[model samples]
Target: MNVINKLKETAVSVFPVMVIVLLLGLTVVPLDKYLLIRFVFGGILLILGLTIFLVGIDLGIQPMGERCGAELTRKRSLSLLLICAFVIGFIVTAAEPDIQVFGSQVRGLFSFVNKNVFTFVIAAGVGIFITIGLLRTVLNISIKWVLFILYAILFGVMIFCPQSFIGIAFDSGGATTGPMTVPFIMALGLGVSSVRSDDENSFGLTGICSIGPIMAVLLYSLYLKSQGNFDSSSVVQISETAEAVAAGSPLSQIFGPFEEISGEVLRDSVISIMPLFGLFILFQAFLLKMTARQVAKIVIGFIYSFIGLTVFLIGVHGGFSQVGSELGFALGSKALSNGGIWFVLLIAVGLVFGAVIVCAEPAVWVLSEQVESVSGGTITRKLLLVFLAIGTAIAICLALIRSVAGFDLKWILIPGYGLSMLLMIFCPSMFSGIAFDSGGVASGPLTSTFVLSFTLGAACVGANGNDSFGVIALVAMMPLIAIQIMGIMFKLKQKKGGQK
Candidate 1:
């Protein structure tokens, strides 16, 4: 029954993307037979793998995170809470596939940013911020004030960080809060808040925690920039021929690419999960010991999570990467050659594509469900989806425009975030938290894989791919304003009801 429901959910998420690709193939961009076949196969794997992965999260990871959070809070020791928070945040983020993907892409473009070092810096940021978030909940600090101060510091740091690092830094905040991190971190937040009688305190930890990576990456970038050690070349070239690699036999073609990725993903997953598992065991042994049956169930859950993650990563790398890159390249190259009308059409397609793709993000579903539950259905999943979709569409349109026109990312990010922060003054506190968190949630695996590839393709043709790095950052930023507008409407409605 659980599997059946998850399958249905996954289908709903993936179907629109398949339809969009088919439309593009028929109308604007016709794919070669090999690329088309790979896409179809990849889409199938995405649905299957995502369904299994989400189920595993529910059965295993979420429960364990909640228990860990609950047990840590139960101890009533500040030092223990901070240490555990840092450790858990770092470990969970280090294993995140989105972060890994983003790091690889950046390394491929700029050889100076070592992938391992980059990932570790982002992980450390999440860890420290998570510690701060936990402290806020325990001490009853206002999320709004915390966010205002942190973002102020973030913008100040941005002045020193190189232009190349700015977009990547903000994008890291979104990417790290992906499938593995969101459910567990959110569940952990709930567990910490559960101890508090106040419902208001139940929300905002994830929102605050999301800020950590942005600041962490920005600070690291500033440090690197200060050392004057890296190349400042803006003329990076993407190979068109790279997208046309020959396909193998049908079976081998479908399964071949996964061979190397499977081993790497499996190793990363094991390394990412074992520490948390070991920590849980230690905590159970010494602090909040559970019954034997409870331990057995959680252990089984961990196994399911590990298997699901391995399969999911294989599907993403094997099925999605090449096709996404190729499609973007094809569309982008065409748009560049055929100017005027074709440029407008390309932008329109980008907007529609962005709108639809958000529905397919697995993390978006988790977030929408949690929001509805927390808001007592005042913010329905459908309503939240609309706001997110619209925001994503706008963000993608801007990204496409920027790729074509060669605008500085700071121009968009500065005013866009300024408006978002301004909205917080008028927005409800809970809505403010959800809005900021949604910015991160909306840019999950699908954005990293498909939308980003599409943007890079456009960047390759329209400009040097230097501008492409910021597309995901734009996807992450726009939702804050869109959702906050919705929050204002909700507040108005509530006030009207009160007056009545």
Candidate 2:
């Protein structure tokens, strides 16, 4: 029954994307039959995989993270807490499927980047910042000051990094906070905050953690720039790869990627979970005195999480990505051939895609539920979802505009982030934290994968050589502004009610 309920919910979240794609094929896009079939198959897998994954998160990941957090913090050793937090953040991030997916894309596009090095650098960034976030929570520092200082430094560093690296760096921030990282990290934050009896602080850990990767990648990009003599000739345009995939593979070749990816995903999933499992065991032995039954349940939960994660990765990588690429190429081609109406059509499609695809993101649901729970239902899940969808929809529109117009990303990003930081002044502090965290959560696995692939394809064809790296960055950013706006509204409503 629980599994069935989860399936129904997951289906609702996922089916809109499938419906939109089918509609596109029937009308404007006209996808290849085989590619469309693969997309449908992948959607089925996505619904199923996401159902199981959510169940596993509830059963194992959240509980375990909360327990570990609370117990670790109870020890009252700041040094120990910071060290453990860093390790947890690093291990979870290193194992994150989203980062792995992003890293693979990066490596494919740029010959100079080593996937392992990139992943490691990103993981280190999350680790360092997770430590900083915890320190802020423990010390009760202001989130606004912390955010202002970090981003100011980020912008300073951004000026020094290569323009190409900027988009990838910002996208890295979003990708690091995917399904594998968000639940555990949010739960862990909740647990830590519980120890301090402070609910507001629970919301900002992921926000702070998101900043780490952008800074780290920017700094790493500077290092790469310093090296100077790399071959630029080997760079593979994302559109080329998307075009190849969009062109359609043989019937035999279609499932072949699935077969190959399943094995690889299974391996990666195990590796991803092991460090956390090992940490749990270490705590179990020394700190987390659990009964045999409790331990058994958690062990089973880990197994479910591992299996679900593997399946989810396969569904995403092998299935939906091709369709996204294909759709983008088709749209891009249309815009090239037929200008005015096609551009409007593309923006409309982007709005719908941005709004719906976010629904399918597991981390978005987790964060929404957290917001509702933490606010004691003052902020309903449905309300937050609406805000997120609107924010995401707007983000996609901007991305489409950028791709179509060939503007520098800084034009959108500088104002977007500036508005977010500025809004922190009037927005309730709790909402400020929630808003920043939502910014991270809103850009999860699907944004990094499908939405990103789509943008790359569009940029390849539509913009005549404009870079396609910043869509995810924009997707990650818009929610900060949106949610903070919601916060200000909520405050005004409260004031109105008091006056009445």
Q: Report residue 4 deviation for candidate 2 (angstroms).
A: 3.4
Candidate 1 residue-wise lDDT, 120-222, digit = tens: 9999999999999889889988777888898889899898887777888888888887766787787788778777754566666777777898898888887
Q: List candidate 2 stretches off by more than 4 Å.
A: 229-238, 241-254, 464-466
Q: How far is candidate 2 from the true structure (C-alpha RMSD, Å)?
A: 2.2
RMSD of each: 2.3, 2.2
The model with the greatest lDDT is 2
Give the number of colliding residue pairs in candidate 2.
0
Among these predictions, the greatest TM-score belongs to: 2
**What lDDT score belongs to each candidate, Candidate 1 first?**
0.79, 0.84
Error at 70, model 1, angstroms: 2.2
lDDT per residue (tens digit) for residues 1-500 in model 2: 28887788789888988999899987877877777777888788888888778887787778888898898889999999999989888988898766777898788778889899999999999999999998998898988889999999999999888888899999999988877788888888888888999987878889999999999999999998888823567567644745344333576556766786788878877877887788889989998898999888888888887778777778887888878877877887788778889888888888988988888888887788778888899999878888888999999988877876688899999999999999999998888888888889888877777887777667777663547588889999999988889999999999999999
